[model samples]
Target: MNEILTKERLIEARERISNQVKRTPILTSSSINKILNANIFFKCENFQKVGAFKFRGASNAVLSLNEKEMINGVATHSSGNHAAALALAAKMKNIPAYIVMPKTAPEIKKKAVAGYGAKIIFCEPTLKAREETLNNVIQETNAIFIHPYDNYDVIAGQSTAAQEIFAELNDLDFIIAPVGGGGLLSGTALSTKYFSPKTKIIGAEPKEADDAFKSFNDKKIYPSINPKTICDGLLTQLSEKTFKIITNTVDEILTAKEETIIEAMKLIWERMKIIIEPSSAVTLAIMIENQEKFLNKKIAIILSGGNVDLKNLPFK
Candidate 1:
């Protein structure tokens, strides 16, 4: 387990990126608590830099680079959040960033990355196309590829969000987070294990994009194939590093239907008065579905992002 990501490493990462990243607040809603019959605390990473928790890992990865590694700058392929995050983090360090984004990526995200001054390459909406385009960019620019969720540094950085949760709230019964590439989930698991070992780590995914759910139960990595869900951020499959970490540390993986996801997102918007993307609501949706498991329990949910395009609201 130490080989994957040590507690000491997580602490160091927190300190490393503390100055760069936002220490987002923990928020709660009485309406949500009464509706779910559980004490829920949300780590609002939506307020984080780049409007998502991805900035935490991106900042850490970019800042961890040595002078030699920083020479060629960094690159990554993301549908939105990570691309914008890496671009902004690189821009902060005055380094070039090359981003490969899917053509179908949200227009707001495309503009955000470009606004950060990163060179954006558009590709088909397939993981293969994104990776192929990224490879060509790396070959041409020799940029250091900072994988969205696969790298240990990125994972360590993501752990800090859970670390923050544990710092303010003690003895949580469970820490739930949305699972996409498993970067955030794996990192949350590690933080739970190290900071509050008794607290279980739960990963929530959309049923339409249940690769992480299937992979966790099967104890094998599964590619995300044609996932169709409103949670755009939860479409990526788990990598070997994140899969191993999640399987070892995560207590369970739960899934929510598309309708439930939308319902959850709408509930937060109306009740909490905060905007959250569909992916961020998966954790809450699972909680609503599995109310029995979490009834009267103290839970911490990571609101992973708030990068939704306002014009494309899912609510009626």
Candidate 2:
């Protein structure tokens, strides 16, 4: 009964973060539907606070903390939207936030995190360095560590995105999301399982960072090392909790080449008139790669984020 990954827990998370978070809109593209010969629904989380869905989980984690937990604030290591999200969420709670960022991270992301009043600590780009830096920050400040995608509260919070999708439209034949650390995909799979049992949960992964695809098929976790994909948000490997949920509930993991990802991202901007990060384009790329499977089906695509460094775009 105390399980945090259950439907009840997700529902509770929805209630908790409802007042603080925006209920992002769902958009449809007639042109894209014609191209794919399928009715595709896009849950646009790009419009979410901090320009990403990471805010939902971060806010949930921050808001869920007890009074004792709040006194020491929170700490996290992320070079993308998660850092900004956690920092902003902690600011909302009127508490201190310690953020560990790689020195090589984009200046935009660094600015976003600092703008939220978090104390930023620079570290080497490697995961080992980030973890070591974050550990030291936590040790020094006694801040609760809020992992980007590994915590149960974070997963439960992420599930609310799919809940909103089902609430608006429930006849989806397939629900697809990009798999980074498996938080969004696993959360989506659980939501689809409860709300639309017939819907297949599919994960879109970059071939350059295809650890999730490999792990899903191999039934084991694999390290993501020096990934050469433009999907910066998805460079991290899956956590044990995420891997377990994904293997159990997800129907499949499809991978897309770098070219396909860039092409899909450009197409969305041109057709849908929406800005999406490369990580978000992975889902559309998967649909394009496997057109036969998705043709004539009603599919839902979760656009993970819109946080892109405009100065460094993959497409012209």
Candidate 3:
């Protein structure tokens, strides 16, 4: 399979997911919508069990794995939600799970993975470290490798979020998703293109990590591994496959600064009464900062995840 996701496989993934992971609420907030002159819908994946949509991909990947591969188990390196999701999903299937995470990753996240009974491997904060460590684990156990955002199957799984969001509000004029490595954005774009052709898909990224925006604008692939952003969840450089889909389907990329992200966190707390990590807050910042553009349009923003460390409120 190709590294990037395709429209056909995204459709197949939507069909293959059998159970309701969660019918997360699609809240219509006319206030923000009206202020921007855009009708806004928030897909509350924060309310999900693990408080993130990573569960969709983890669960799908676990179920779809070949029996032999399932027996050998699965492994991946993720900072937080994805690790917890993989561990829990594998547990549900009665398979072992191995997670690799940077030592600097939040202790809360590490605890979550351990709590789910996964062996946690700590590594340095670099792509080379993550890949080399993951490779060793794979070779030793013969575990199937499930990439966080790079693989076609993973992207197809993430697309399930878009399927749910659009299913909840079929007439949205556009969709906005947090673009870390572009898994969610690519998946959503492919699915939206197939299922809701009229709906425009836009990606939201931090100004500090503007490779997606720059790459799209420059019409060239810009590679940056471990680019610095308050959105640790958005730190992964886009995969080659995900980059292609975002380049093709996403209409525009919105950039928000670290300060705007802090304000966005405060807004979600005060108005929405939801806790979101800095990564998710970046997307909200985009909406508020560019209110004039989003205003009065039928729009949906995937509140991707709520995995912030409670002690790090306001992101230090």
Candidate 4:
């Protein structure tokens, strides 16, 4: 079925974006495996185009458009990776991309999105500012809005990462991924359950930005305004569609300290030589902090993204 939000749509997105996106490698790390007392498989989405898996969802959404939609162009708001991905995807498809970004978004991300030929609209760091900016642009150009994570097509495209990971490592007892706006987590939960119903799904959220965690417990997902966290990406509230999936499919919501995130990032970089952003490293932080709980189990973790600034390396 071509219906929106259907499992078939996710499967279709997996098939449609395969050519543009990498089936990012699933790696087994001896160091991590030894420490966790479990078999660990790393789904390295950092190796994806644009230094993150955001490219997959954004590209799929942009490229699946009809000629009419393409002509109207695509508009979106992102702190960084999604903007760059959307910009690059639209450029590749010969469509104009309009990106609204928080003024405080990293300079590197801004430059990368601009470099991809997307027109940029700078806004305050509030969701209100972003939505307003996006609306103005859409009204002016009649562009189709490609939300960063809320859209079904985007979630479906993001789910493909798990499809690839589970395909390679079918015996995983659990799959752990970092949650930010719940795109990856929602996609992961749906896809993982669809393929291996027995595999437990868990999401790692920053303690500082624990909306999803609180939402899970309270049974009502609440949207917060600019929650403080070093995991910059994990600041938004869970979407309605996303919260429903997590409520039903996710076995648990895990949290990790900001300091633990830094430590985890360092360990992966120094020990395994794999670079992961603090946001991405939160999953490892969860595993490290909750070590005894995961003993002897096989786990799959998504190394979500690697867009950390080099000058901002952890203090040794």
TM-score of each: 0.97, 0.98, 0.92, 0.96
Per-residue lDDT tens digits for candidate 3, residues 180-289, read 78888888888788778898888999998988888888877787654777787887667778878788889999999989989877867766777777788787789878
Model 2 pairs whose backbones collide: none
Q: Can you tell me which runs of candidate 3 are displaced by over 4 Å?
A: 1-8
RMSDs, each prediction? Answer: 1.1, 1.3, 2.4, 1.7
Sorted on lDDT, highest at the top, how do the candidates line up? 1, 2, 4, 3
Off by over 4 Å in 4: 1-4
Q: Give the 10-residue window scoring lowest on summed lDDT in candidate 1.
A: 1-10
- Model 3: worst 10 consecutive residues (lDDT sum): 1-10
lDDT of 3 at 122: 90
lDDT of each: 0.93, 0.91, 0.80, 0.86
Q: List, residue by residue over 80-180, the lDDT tens digit for candidate 1.
A: 78888999999999999999988887777788899999999999987679889999999999999999999999999999999999989998999999999
- In angstroms, the error of model 4 at 291 is 1.2
